[model samples]
Target: MQTIRSINLQKNLGDVLRTADVETVLVTNRDQPRAVVMSAEEFIRLKTAAGEPVPNEVRKSSPTLHRRIADPLGYDTRDPGYVEQTASDALDGQHADEIAREIDKAMRRWRLR
Candidate 1:
């Protein structure tokens, strides 16, 4: 973001508008930020985003909406929570732990042979 004092903004309105299209611009009055200038695309994007409600978990995890911003992993939208719920229900947490221990014991016994 670039900071432009109110005096500079008025004096260089064309230059300031050009800069704002490339990136966000902060307008300040007496060294205090008073307003922001962003491109039309950015303004529309922010307006659309403001209309939607985000999940609490997602909000807490990423205040800047950084979730899935980098190296995003694709998910199958065709199958919703039901598929995941069914798969998770297939194995209880306790039973999975017990099975893991049993496998470790068997692997150790085999290694001793």
Candidate 2:
């Protein structure tokens, strides 16, 4: 990626467009990035990967997902005496045989295959 000031972008539009075809070019205004220039193929690929849901809509619909997105580390380490726990209780030193028995019981209870 390359950063170009707004004035420089205007002066070197042709070269910037050519560069953007190969990689991303960030356009900056007043030293802050204002826009991105990339190939149409790259733009489409990124949009497809991102999916259709807007961030605010997703945040409003699911609080748990919103928290996960806001804190990718699962929990805030900045909290006093914060203890990071594993994602699942089943992984807490359970033997394979015990886990298999629990899974079998759950499957039978739930009528799941």
The CA lDDT at 3 in model 2 is: 89
Q: Write model 1 residue lDDT over 1-113, tens digit each, in one string.
A: 99999988888888889998789999999999999988655665565579954344322322122344421222232223334754564454534555566578778979952
Q: What is the C-alpha RMSD of each candidate to the true structure, in Å?
A: 13.9, 14.5
lDDT of prediction 1: 0.63
Q: Write the per-residue lDDT of candidate 2 for residues 2-111, one digit (tens) a residue.
A: 98999888789999999987999999999998999987556655755789533442223221244345433334332212232422333565345655765897799899
C-alpha lDDT values of all predictions: 0.63, 0.64
Best candidate, lDDT: 2
In order of appearance, the predictions have TM-scores of: 0.44, 0.44
TM-score of 2: 0.44
